[model samples]
Target: MPSPARAAAFAAAARTILAVTLAVLLAMAGGALAADAPAGKAGPEKAANASAAGSGDDEDEDDDEDEDEDEDDEDDYEGMPPGDGRDEVFAYCSACHSMKLVTQQGLTRADWAEVLVYMVEEHEMAEIEPEDEKLVLDYLARFYGRDRRARKMGR
Candidate 1:
């Protein structure tokens, strides 16, 4: 029912509307892509923090591994005989503290037990079985007993 000029005008209006819609859609898409695009440059502080975090994680892993190795050394006597459970005590003791604690103390079995108890009670040392403690004490008493005569002579 439209006249010729009116039909042409309506067609041109519809075409103009479509062009505007297309332009808006393109602008939105361009904005979205720009938002997602990588930042071409990072600030120095951000870059330094990221680098330090990564390096810290690696160092923590290495430190944890070393602690694990120390614990293992304190527990295992892979080559020692069962009768020689003193080795286990030595292993456990030498893991965190030093063997000097044992060697330097001119201690009897009772003295060693007291020291072990002190370590467990005060310093939060590992819990050792009573029998294991006895065995280690006996071994130390037998092997590294004090030279009484030398002490008496004082020479």
Candidate 2:
């Protein structure tokens, strides 16, 4: 029969081998995910290339079209309307989800405030600064408020 010390050493070695194998498997899985990711997904090299490509193209109309395409590629908050607090709302909300999730809502200002609180408490979203929170609430209430029919009719 094997001695206790020998068995312990064998067990330890087996565990070490298992851990190394698991680590290698995890690394391969991560590599596969990265390979499958879309080409335009965020990367430092892609950002530098986008900006550099757009900078020198101001002299030609065709270049302007190319620049617009580049801008569209980088546009994360495409559906949100232009407004005073649009940037603040987009920067905060789009970190976790698509801007369409926000644009489809038609809540009053108080309900919008409640949603923000719910996001922070339930979904672990970061709390907005007080000033920025006010701006975001104002923007949401104005553009996505409950009187959607009225606003559309006016337009």
Candidate 3:
């Protein structure tokens, strides 16, 4: 058998190897999560202003022009059905991207829930209140659901 001191040294070395292995695994998991994280914070206005402020006045003017175009695009949702959560979806969802994107999707209620979770986790959307979440899900599942699209398209 090995000497007592040699056995103790071997045990210590095994522990050291195990610790280093765990540290590397944890670091790799952290890197993966960071990679999946959104590009930046939630607010488009803040991001826009920060970039504009970093550049000169000419770029600021260009940003204003871009805002004007965004306003024009916002009109695309004018025909959205008026109801309990219409305003909530319009305000929250459109803050990041166009409402056209919202209109284009025909997801189930479960899928919409998953989308909300994705928005919060991956895209940094604010956590919505439970009541408002229900309203939004109801509206989306009623009006923008796969069944409705299927009926409309005769699929």
- TM-score, each model? 0.40, 0.51, 0.50
Scanning candidate 1 in windows of ten residues, the lowest lDDT window is 38-47
Point out where model 1 deviates above 4 Å. Answer: 1-83, 148-155
Ranking by TM-score: 2, 3, 1
Residues 1-155, model 3: lDDT tens digits: 99999999999999999999999999999999786433223333443454467566554366777767456433434445545566567656866886668887899999999999999999999888898799889888887899978987899
Ranking by lDDT: 2, 3, 1
Higher-scoring candidate on lDDT, 1 or 3: 3
| Candidate 2, 98-141: lDDT as tens digits | 77788888899999999999999999998899988998999999
> What value of lDDT does candidate 1 attain over all alpha carbons?
0.59
Which 10 residues in a row give candidate 3 its minimum summed lDDT?
A: 36-45
lDDT tens per residue, model 1, 51-148: 46755445436677766754543333322223344454555566555555555556666766787789889888878777677777776665445553
The lDDT of model 2 is 0.76
Displacement of residue 30 (Cα, Å) in model 2 is: 12
Please tell me which model should have the higher TM-score, number 1 or number 3.
Answer: 3
The CA root-mean-square deviation of candidate 2, after full C-alpha superposition on the true structure, stands at 7.1
Candidate 3 or 2, higher lDDT: 2
Q: Report the alpha-carbon TM-score of model 2 versus the true structure.
A: 0.51
